[model samples]
Target chain A: MKAIHHIEKQTGKAFKLKKGAFLTVIDPMGQQVSDMVLFNSHDVNEKLSSGKSLDFEESILLTKGHFLWSNRSNKMVKIIEDTNGRNDFLLAPCSKETFEIMYNYKGYHPSCLENLYTNLKPFGLSMDDIPTAFNIFMNVQFDQKGKLSVLPPTSKGGDYIKFEAQMDLLVALTACSAEDSNGGRFKPIHYIIEE
Target chain B: MKAIHHIEKQTGKAFKLKKGAFLTVIDPMGQQVSDMVLFNSHDVNEKLSSGKSLDFEESILLTKGHFLWSNRSNKMVKIIEDTNGRNDFLLAPCSKETFEIMYNYKGYHPSCLENLYTNLKPFGLSMDDIPTAFNIFMNVQFDQKGKLSVLPPTSKGGDYIKFEAQMDLLVALTACSAEDSNGGRFKPIHYIIEE
Candidate 1:
């Protein structure tokens, strides 16, 4: 497939993808996390639900051959390829308060919530439309005691995950702005949608 | 105010609530849990987010004077009156797999997922639209060690929680089908919407 559209998503930027298309998200700088939220193109109410996806897959890890299920819809997108095999499914998208509560960052910092609202506004969506996202390329592990922590991505430059849109989709992706657990800066993400 | 509509929701039934409306969900038989999901009337992409509500209120319990925030939207519904004062905000609505994995329930048992889908279809919504819900009247508590358990509701017959819509909204509610933590049977719920 050839690229029909390319988006160089900087930290906290967002973009959309259409249906019957393939989107490959690239970690150009490597070890950086990306947050993504998906919704039906025609109906904003029909958005991806990580809880339902986890329940449907019966696993905490989303990998190749797994489908991302929207809360009401049976399938929205499918993971066709995974380079890192370490994407996170457990963490909700980082919000402004997440920075404050989790990292003790004060004042306005970059957040997936703000990025999504800013990007979605052209399509008539706002903060109310932001949903929990699939944190692509994020490494999160839980200990036996159930304590969880985010880790730096294991991906190298040019590493990517490809998703096949099961329906016409409107996806919002954010090159996360939070420091990784290892205190490394978040890097840029690149994506292309091809027919 | 008089009820514009009233529904006698048997176990596993779902219904919708419109905007600018007051919805009173009653634990008619007492100790029964109700699972509720809300969406923006014009856009399914925006659904209620318990995480956002918890963060907005800085509390885990949904009580009178608290506003339920959608993940992106600031507030979607307000708890105008809560008689039981014990509404849960932590548990996702129970699904078939939850029953199977958690309780060893076998075969076609009812589920909040199915109920929400069945009820939402009339509004042109399907499974993808079912976001995580506000599990009203469900008694869930976390122990000091952070172990969570669902306890039987403290509500008696006629106990209810009332909510006022903050936007034009569509709500799907189910009289939950899972057995309570105490192994009690799930009971019916009733609700009325007043303009």
Candidate 2:
């Protein structure tokens, strides 16, 4: 294989992205993903139900290149690989206090933010620079009573998410450090950010 | 204030735990937790660097919680809870890939086999019945190495961690989220986890 270092300039030695792009969703390699839910952080207003024609917004939100987990299994998973364009992304870690309010507060952990900072140093990112994102596989939804209900994630093991970029963007990812009891399971979600 | 419905147990609030007496670290209200390590799971050979300090193991892991975002910010952040114990606890989350490699790709996510699993679900322990842990916010000197290194974390954006149990625990904390940023800048260094 010919090794190509860095693309100093925009060289047209590549492929073109169509107006519409495609993505693939699957479970992480060697994981048994269970119940989980994922929503687009950029656009919470968009809706896309399974077994239906996904809209443009759904396409972006459910696009591959992102992943989710739940119940030690990944029911709905996606991993996006945007060749046409780029996608903006963010990475957020989980913690405890939210645990008690969310559940019986069974599982407890150290600061995931602390982990993100330590690992990001290898890549050169920082806490302040990190953007906000949805808690993948975390099934949180609003009800008719305007109450937020918790749903098990829709992702299963080995599930992945893929999508084409709508535009040029920066994506950040981390192998979350949530406790195993809640079922995020500390399983490393497969993350591949490629051109 | 209106009184909420309270149920009186005929047995006088008797509870049953695996152990007659359960031990864990604690952090009370308005307390300043200090330097300590949190593992993703219970530690077997975890050695301390000082006098015989009392320690406890979390019955489960920690995925998400509420915690103040400042070590010295003096600002009380919510959701400042994770894990059952305060210090000397692990069981934080890692990436899905890290999950596979660390465990030789044998177990699944949030499976509690890998650290990732424990991070997602703490007490529901699975796979190995307990996963290895990432020492978050703790200074350790491995037996093989004489130098002590800080075990940071991965998290950001008003992130907080807390722990809740029949009992409470105190723990020192630090916000980690810069992989390769300047001295953990994406998020500045703040030691929260206070009361």
Candidate 3:
């Protein structure tokens, strides 16, 4: 329920966007993301809430990008941009395979995503059916042929898109696998979610 | 080797720093971080590969101001500004106390630091000695009496205090726990690790 203004310091101009407007993501980098996925819930069905642990059925239902939910408000939060790549963050899913690949698998933290699953599985969630999601910052671009591949990000400080969430949604995001050397060293990204 | 220049885009100025700099961060805003915690890793002695997991030591070390660390190249990375009021970060460690205070124990994430310790105990780590970290970007400040308290950040994009990592240290960082309500949520941030 607060208002955020997008100001470009270079020109000292600001864009006063509509509060609770739809989400709009813009990819300025001009590239494609590999295996980038989008998932939505059916707001009309109203299958999710803060207390409800997400399930395979609910996750699968979200495949069409239409199993809509709401935030605290009835307004919408847009998936404005996939600035960098289009991959669904490469379901690497933090496995021992990942540990072995990254750190010789000799000594893993034992608490990667796989460990998360082993712990959370008791609550009725399944990673197998984890809905593919749009990688927010990673970029995946398309060629003229629409061939999917990873690309660099077109987003910067002043560059941003807008969107509206039709309903209150519980969003799950995996920052990214700490594999590649992009994203300028996993520095913090400040997200300005507004009303 | 690559050099990361913290560029102040508006003024066209840059702080050209080498890779692996010793960065001392401060949280101006001592706000209750609902999401992630930030910190200033004054010095992490464990060895680190280019991309690897940081072994957070059990004891918390408060990196004093003006402390210095040298890299493999023997380059100096000084703590130019070890302590500032939370320019744009919160200074809080991740713990059950932090969670209880911030979220009011309303909800519990199984993976919280408290839980992280339970799982890590088997690995010879305990909750008392898990990790001590500063909440970067959330804002914390020092009063005239030198009292540490949380505040809002005063940092703009590209306005970073640079330090050369005295050595290749495994650093694990995530975006702050703030939203677009403030100046966050748009672009997470661009922290380049120039090697």
Best candidate (score: TM-score): 1
State the lDDT of candidate 1 residue by residue for B1-195, as single tens digits: 564233344344444556778888888778888888888878776778865665446455668998887765457999999999887654556777677766788888778878888888888877755667888887766443333566788888899899998888888887777776323776677888887
For candidate 3, write residues B23-57 as lDDT tens digits.
43222222222222111233322211100111111
- Greater-lDDT candidate between 2 and 3: 3
After TM-score superposition, the amount by which residue B28's alpha carbon in candidate 3 deviates from its true location, in angstroms, is 17
Residue B165 miss distance in model 2 (angstroms): 30
Worst 10 residues of 2 chain B by lDDT: B49-58
DockQ class, candidate 3: incorrect
Predicted candidate 2 versus true structure: per-residue lDDT over B1-195, tens digit per residue: 322111111000111112112212222211222222222223211212110110011111212342222211111222234442222222222334333533345544321123223232333423322212222322221121111122333232233233332112212222222121112222222222212
A1-195, model 1: which lDDT tens digit per residue?
A: 565333343345445566767888888877877888888888877787765675556466787888898756358899999998778655567678777755688898877677777888887887766667788887766543333566688888888899999988888888777675323775677887786
Between candidates 1 and 2, the one scoring higher on DockQ is 1
Candidate 3 residue lDDT tens string, A120-149: 344344433222233444443323221234
> CA lDDT, every prediction?
0.72, 0.27, 0.30
Q: List, for all models, the DockQ compared with the true complex.
A: 0.13, 0.02, 0.01
| Candidate 1 residue spans exceeding 4 A from truth | A1-18, A181-183, B1-130, B134-175, B178-195
Give the per-prediction TM-score of chain B: 0.90, 0.22, 0.44
Best by DockQ: 1
Better of 1 and 2 by lDDT: 1
Candidate number with greatest lDDT: 1
